[model samples]
Target: MVRTIRHRTMTTNSSKTPSSHATRQQNSNKLSRTKKACFGLMTTVLGLVAIELTLALLGVGRSNADGDPMMGFSKQVPLLERYVDEDGKAWMRTAENKLVWFNDQRFPLTKPANTQRIFCLGGSTTFGRPYDDNTSFAGWLREWLPHVDASSRYEVFNAGGVSYASYRVAAVMEELANHEPDLFIVYTGQNEFLERRTYADFFEQTKAQLWLTGLVSQTRTYAAIDSILRKNAPQESDADSIVLAAEVDERLNHTVGPSDYVRDDEWSDKVREHFKFNIRRMIHIARSANAKILFVVPASNEKDCSPFKPDSEDGSFETGQRSFDAGDFASARAAFQLAIDRDICPLRAPSNFAQFIRDLPESDDVRVLDFESELRNVCIDEHGHDILGEEYFLDHVHPTIDAHRQLSRWLISEMREAGWMAADSIALNELSAETVEGVDQSILGRIDRTAQGIAMRNLAKVMHWAGRFEVAAPRARDAIELLDGDAESQFILADCLRWTGQIDEAVVEFEKGVSAYPTYFRGVQRYGLLLLELGDNDAAREMFSIATLGWPETDPRHWAARFQLSIAHLGACDFESAHRELQECREHTPGDMDVVFAIAEASVGIGEPEKAIELYEQVLDEFPNDVDTHLNLAHTLLSTKQTDRAAGHFATALSLAPDNERAQAGMMVIDQLKQSAE
Candidate 1:
């Protein structure tokens, strides 16, 4: 019995050991599973928190899912259009499409029968802002000029539009060429420099933007990838837009690289060339369309108001300086000094710009009037703050109503000097009428007689210059009757007859004018130009030579005479003589593109394509955005068998000015060639 108990205890002990081992293994597995589950839950919760934090930091939650800002405000707004009233008969829209109407009836276009109609073309100042129509320069002109005769009346039409430059004014002239006005008055020059970019600069920027946009659009897939990367990236500061806008404005205004602050002489040359080219084109169009063109140089704010002076030692004129320098005599003197330093003297600068215009042989027909000195004198007050005073300007730039009035008065004086006035019969009737019954008749009669002669002579001269042969002839005859054998009148009569297909009669009048005023280059030059047109080459050349000898070297007519002589040589097929004349022109004026192009054409005629190519390249270098140059260069390249290079340039040219047919055709050929090569 004891042996059996021992055996049972041993068995029990063995069984308990196995069961403990199994229980220990089960507890170890359960602990491992619980640890893994806890770690996974913590990781998932942390990841969700991180995502929420990122969205909040990016401001993504405030924006729509598509990435637009939640607010409905747009960054850009459309530009407003502007318009204005023209005369009493019609309303005209401004370039920006704003509506304006004249408040006065005195400047009405509808006068009595046979009125001397004057149409004025210019920009905003000419439009007479802040002044009612009755108080405008047009109204003043109407009040000033009496009717010429019973058959004639006096009327002034203010056709000026706000912000219009010479180009737009030319367009208006073209539109009104058939109106049969006795005179077309043009007052401009200020807006030309400010309103539009030089043609070359405009085209260059246009091309660059187009090409860059095209390249960007072509790489849209890459852009999309970048957008995705940017979205996933960490958020940063948001001051980029303000900085970018400033950079853009600077680029647009300066047109030069930011690192460079010095004036770009190359760009200045391009600008000069551009203005010269466009002005020449304008003159040609005006002459061809029989419109008398007169240029008016406007006063500069700096010249009228600023008080800066250049340092004589360094030639540096600091801008934005409005304080007088020590020892300056007056504010006006200081302002004038500042203007001279900045090259803002309207008379001087416009004359310089006009000199460039006149340098072109094709621009001999246009006339330039210098009103700078007169306007300057008129603009200054006794206190030297300008006639309109400091408070009359919105800024340093634009003029107020009071300023406009001053401008008007100045313009009226110039017009009077130029001999623009009304008719005799209308003057007599107006003086005799109830409106002026109480006025002084003797003073009115004397004024009327003086005005009649001046008006008739001026009307005749304007018409003759404009190539209105039929209309001008009668006016000239009338002038000769009223002014009593005036030499200038005879010269104008001769020009009118000559242009109207009455050569012999014109020669007679020209001879009479020359006999009366032997030193008058005007008569001589007109005769010379007429002779040239009639193919009397030798006579034309002689007349031009004589005129040059009589006129001062600095005179515009002197250069004009030289140009005519050059044309005569060119017409005679004397390329050597022509070249000599052109060289003289270049010596007098460097970078004259018209002369340069003419020289290049002469070189081409002489079978010097290599020289032509060089000149053409020079032109392109100077005016890379000139469509004509690009076309010419493409032609030259094609002649030289540079097909691929020419194709690339043509493509670039077309990209800049999409309306270029030649470039488009060239591009098409290039595509075909490339495809065949592939």
Candidate 2:
């Protein structure tokens, strides 16, 4: 006989039946209900599968206009599916109002026969962060290209993205194979530690999972869903929304976010390994596609800007700390320098990563542009030590706007030397130092105030991440003041206020952020969470509900809001309401293992073990490495007297998360069952 599932809080009929026939009728009704639920679930799954297949077949949601997939951090980069030229070429208008090629520039869908195309790939530095494309090194290179090679129409596309690590660049290069790229110039490695996305995590995914993620990412469904989940108030102005994108997408803001800190040597080793492999893979991909590669060694502010993360407690670092505490500034500086050189684990890449980059060129087909050395040579102090202070760098790694201009001049020289451009070109001498400096300053003047605000907020966030809260908080205020009505700056200010123990003030700023932009998820979600912390569950629920009301039905944030609301309901012992919310969340995030498990918990709460079992199984298939899913599935199987199957899952859960109390208890239960059976 199957064991009965214990329902939480819900009262059921406990009165005795009138007769045997009445009892039999009740059993038949239960069977019918179970079958109906199963059939409904199956139908939903089948329908989704059919839709996915059809969309894939039609190629309705694939590459952007430039044939690149939507970039990572999809929300930051907006897709302009709105514009299609007469030739059917899709164009993406950025938050800056510049209608650029989907990935780089708007050109013919096919490369023009008379054009010599050179593609530059990197992270925010290459993308010209805190400034527009006109001020970028790539922009400088584009103008210089025609000077050196007047015979051909030069096309230098800057294929850089904000926060794109080397692995992402590798993926882009792999896709560039079909585009007939004449030359591929890479200037990455700075962001490798920023995002730390590995090849396995970034590219190695099941075909089905990839298809689903890619399809949703490429379609406008996600944007609509994001808007809905954000509770984008219909009354919000377009200008306000545009400002939100700049603030949110500002690379400086992430100087201390998720990918900023590295704790140990093991993790550092993994990131370094991935970086090496990705760069090699990128070169191979370009070479195989018949494109010559110019790998630029990335540089940073080593002497002046403090390390984004604390150095590992190696002997040298410990000695440096001791020297500093002893008031020996000279010894301390030397020791600190040694620590930086010897520290086994650092957030930003050490000198060795640069060395590897400089050594990338081995043959005529490949060459290295040593910007790392060039920056060091020009940034030296009278004492003969390398000095990279605020004058040269905007922050820890990003260069000042002036540096970008000089970088372009250096790259031009390297191009001439590498035979990429003819040395005899009359324009080589025409690119005078005075001319480049004048151009750089001119572009700096053209930069929008809002862009300047973004740079400030980013710098503020980095300071906050570095634990200089006192410094960061005021800068955040300045950012909001600089860019009036900017919701992103307001959000950052609120974050700073919250960290500084100014709870009420934080709430006010968060409210302002949400008011400025209705569909801003960070503002809404953070505000709701703060309310929850303050014991305002009712208010939190209302906020989350309003957020989900207009959001895409399938958005992850929609499901996230529902899940949180469900938890709140569950805490209040409102099991029925909790179950309802969980069901809705599951529908929205059907592919999400967490949502699936949450629904399973709801099924268990409502005294439906079979349903819980089915949901848990689905979760397992999606996330095989998830110990909690395996543990939950084992518990469900054990409740149903499936001891043998339960034991296997229990073992898997134990293997995945050793010393887990639940898995240990589950093992004991399985052992007792085995002994009893014997």
**lDDT of each structure?**
0.54, 0.66
> Which ten residues in a row are the worst by lDDT in model 2?
239-248
TM-scores, one per candidate: 0.33, 0.48
**Error of model 2, residue 361, in angstroms:** 3.7
Candidate 1 deviant stretches above 4 angstroms = 1-113, 130-135, 147-151, 195-264, 277-286, 289-291, 303-369, 379-678
Tens digits of per-residue lDDT for model 1, 1-678 = 887899898898887765777889988889989988998898877875675566567554321111111111122211111233543354322223223322222233223456566676666556654323343455445554542223446556776655555545555555445455556666655444432232323334555674564444333343445468758966542432111110012221353211222344454455455444445445544555554454555544443232122233432223223333333336535444445434421212334554443343422334455444444455554444333223443222344434544554555444444444322223333344643432223223334444455656775664444333554566567668877767777788888777667889988888787778877877888888888888988888888888888767787667667777877877777666767777787677678776666566556556666776788778877877877767666766777778877787787799888988988887887788789889
Error of 2 at 574 (Å): 38
Which candidate wins on TM-score?
A: 2
List candidate 2 stretches off by more than 4 Å: 1-104, 194-264, 312-347, 381-384, 427-429, 432-438, 465-678
The TM-score of candidate 2 is 0.48
lDDT of 2 by residue, 1-678 (tens): 122443321223334333578879988999999999999999987876676667677554533322223223323343222456777876432224423322346434467777867888887788876555666788778766665567777777777766667756776676555567878888887765543332324335566885676566544444445457658556554331212232123333565443434455655666676678677767767777788888888766544444434444555545655765676655755665565555332435576788898877567778888886787677554334344445566655667667887788787777667776654654456767876556556666677777778767887766666654544665577678778856666777787788778998998888788777877765677677777777778777766766666457666676677787776666556668888987776666567677677778778778888999998888777788888888888998888888889999999999988899999999999999889889
User: Count of backbone clashes for each model?
Assistant: 23, 7
